[model samples]
Target: MRLLVTGGSGYLGAAILKRAPATCELAATYLAHSIAQGNAAAFRVDVRDADAVNHLFDEFRPAVVMHAAAQMTGDQMLAVNGDGSRNIARAATRVGARLIHLSSDVIFDGEHAPYDESAPPNPISPYGESKARAERVVLDELPRAVIVRTSLIYGFDPLDPRTRQTLNGEMPRLFTDEYRCPIFVDDLADALLELAQHEFVGVLNLAGAQRLSRYEFGIKMANAFHAAPRFTGALSASYPGRRPRDCTLDISLAQKTLRTRLRGVDEVLQDLPGF
Candidate 1:
């Protein structure tokens, strides 16, 4: 399979590149950060530019496109995350490539926990709103696209941003009430590739099997990094703006469908060689 992975240098994409099957021919695209793909070729393509994306499609002619490039926060959220997604979807359709877009659980408000694919999107944060728009854009452009809604991704090797932040003692207080199903990067990567080779489309929740609060997730990180639990104090998120409380996903469909198992934080942490 000729495949293209956007955001090649990013956390999740890097993991995918590392774990992708040997049978598949992979090319990864990056914006800024330089990636060292052992076998896969690395290309520079900005998803925000429609012409650039089209050029990439013409050049690479990828059979499967993993739309993982995203603008996580700030004012550029709509432009890079929303419009950028539209560009990718259109380009992917032009090339007749199966698009697998990565989406977040924050699309739904925390009032509802264990969200299924049928849940309506009611995003509170700017990032979440942008992702919700991205999803719509992808589906509208490519009806056969697979939208994988996942949660906080962690890798025990201290590469993932969230894992790095916690291990380095960057977070002052971890929210005790905020709940999410944190999946290991490797597990998520494997599941994504398995989904890519299939004809399955529409939204699918691909997250960790176990759901826990942000505080508990930090405790797992602490266990892996050998950090003090006291460093990650319990602090309920409080703000004037609406904050998602429990963006936990229901991965029952993925569990029943895919052969690749989505392992939880606890299981992953216990198996971490560095821990």
Candidate 2:
């Protein structure tokens, strides 16, 4: 099977490239950083540029296209999150290729405990609004397209110092009142590939099984990595914008349909080899 992955250098995309079957013909595109190791060919293209995206699509003619590229920001989530995704969706539709678009749990207002694919999006943040809009474009353009909504992705990155620091220090400290279901990037990559093989369509929540506060997750990370635990309480109100109290998702659909099982914190930690 030939597959094209956008955002090939990203955390999830890179992991997917690494885990994909050796027989699969892989082609990837990136805007900023390029992944050096993969069986697939890599191209530098901006997803927002329809012409550029189309050019690559025509050249690759992939059986499956994983649209993982998007613009994101910690301070401003809407501008890149919502608008940028729409552009990618448009290009994916134009190519008549099966698309698996990555989405986020932020689409929900965080009122409910565990949301399903049927849950109506009631986004409270600009970032959420962007993903909601992106979903609409994909469904409208291609009903067969899959929208995977995941949350709190955690993994170690040798090249990304920020990710390392966040996992080792800042992330644990932020976790007091904040709660989320964190999925490991490796597990998520496997799931995405499995999802690509299925005929599943529409929004599917891909997340870990357990609901943990930032503090609890930090403790788990520390234990897994043999690092000292660091946590400090912070009120949700202290943040600049409104956020859902608990945005964890229920991944029963993915677990039942896909080969990769969505694991909880304990399960994931147990699987983690000593490093």
Candidate 3:
């Protein structure tokens, strides 16, 4: 398969590159930091620029496109996540490539618990709104595209951002009420690869089997890291802006469909030595 992965420098993108099949012709795009994983060719292209995206798509002409490039926050969120997604979708459509766009659980308002594939997006925050918009544009451009909505992607190989922040004492308080199904990065990568070959389209919730609060996830990470967990628990209300309280996903469809086992955070943590 000729595969193209955007945001190759990001955590999940890097993991995918590392685990992708050797038989596949791999190509990845990054805005700044370039990657050198195996034989995967890295291209520096800004997804925000439609011309650049189209040019890369024309050159690579991938059989499958994993659109992982996104801006989670700040002023460029909408432009990067929403408009960038539209550009990728249109480019992939032109090339007749199977598009598997990564989405987030934050799209829901959190008033709804254990969201399934059919759950309509009711974003509460800017990040969520941007992702929801990304989903809409991607679907509009490529109706057959697989919109994979996932949760907190964590891995120990090169500690994920959230866990690293907590370990470095950058996070003062972890939310006790905010619930999510944090998937192991490896599991998510494997699942995405499996999805690439399949004909499955539309929204698919691919998250961890277990759901837990952010505080619980942090404590587990600290314990697994063999560091003293120091962060205090705080309710979502204490958070400055509106935060999703229960963005937990229902991965029953994914569980039933794919052979890839989506392990939970607890199971993943236990895989560590002396855990």
Candidate 4:
């Protein structure tokens, strides 16, 4: 199997590359970061450029395209996350490659609890809106696309960007009201790779087993890193503008569908290696 992973240098993408199947031919894409660790060949790609995406597809002829690249904020969110996804979806359809697009729980309004695959997207933030648009575009362009809607990704060892910042006191304030099913980066990567080899299509909630607030997650990180000074007792309301609350995903379908065990935060962090 030939697999191409976009955002290969990203936290989740890098994790996926590390645990990817050896039998499969692997390739990775990056925008700003370097492909330092993986055996996969590196390709600099801007998913917004249809021609660039199509050219990569033609050259690589990837059997599976894992579209993990996306802008976090600003107008780039619309250009890269929204439209870039469409470009990738179109290119994947043209090349007959199975597309697996990464999505987020923030696509839905926090008013709803434990959202399912069928729940309608009512995004509150610019980033969330972009993901919602991306999902629609991917599904429209490639009906067979697998859109994996996940929550906040966390891990130690090399450490995730957000987690590392929190450890260094960079992200001092974690909201108490913003709830999510924080999945281990490895678990999510495994689920994505497993889905890549399957015939499953459409939306699937791939997240951790337990639902908890960001504050709760932060506390766990603090305990793990022994960094209690960074903790600022804040709520979601303390932040400027809108923030999604209680966007925990209902993963019953995923639990029944996937072979990989989607371990919860407590389970994952308890046995964490190398502190």
User: Which predicted model would earn the best lDDT?
Assistant: 3
Q: Against the hidden reference, what TM-scores do the models get?
A: 0.96, 0.91, 0.98, 0.97
Could you tell me how far off, in angstroms, the CA of residue 105 lies in candidate 1 after the best superposition?
A: 0.2
Model 3 lDDT tens row, 50-114: 99999999999999999998988799999999999999999999999999999999999999898
Clashing pairs in 2: 82-130, 175-214, 175-215
Instruction: Summarize candidate 2's per-residue lDDT along 141-254 as a digit string, tens digits.
Output: 778788999987777654234336655565534636667898888789899998888888877889988888766776776667776655565667777889877887989988
lDDT ranking of the models: 3, 4, 1, 2
Q: Against the true structure, what is every candidate's RMSD? A: 1.4, 2.3, 1.0, 1.1
The C-alpha stretches of model 4 lying farther than 4 A from their native spots are none
- Model 2 CA deviation exceeding 4 Å by range: 74-80, 157-163
lDDT of 4 by residue, 1-275 (tens): 89999999888888889989899898989988898755898999889888898889999999999999988877699999989999999999998999999999999889988799899999999999999999999999999999999999988757888888877888878888889999999999999999999878889999999998888888888887776748686988878899888998999999989999999988887777755
Among residues 3 or more apart in sequence or in different chains, the pairs in candidate 1 whose N, CA or C atoms overlap within 3 Å are none
Tens digit of lDDT per residue, candidate 1, span 1-275? Answer: 99899998888888898889899899989988988677678889888889998988898899999989998978988998899999999998998899999999999988978799999999988999999999999999999999999999887543788767776778767888889999888999999999988878889999998899888888877766566764555645554567799999999999888999898877877776757
Relative to the true structure, candidate 1 reaches a TM of: 0.96
Q: Candidate 4 local accuracy as lDDT?
A: 0.90
**Candidate 4 minimal-lDDT segment of 10 residues:** 224-233
Against the reference, the lDDT scores of all candidates come to: 0.87, 0.78, 0.92, 0.90
Which candidate ranks first by TM-score, i.e. highest?
Answer: 3
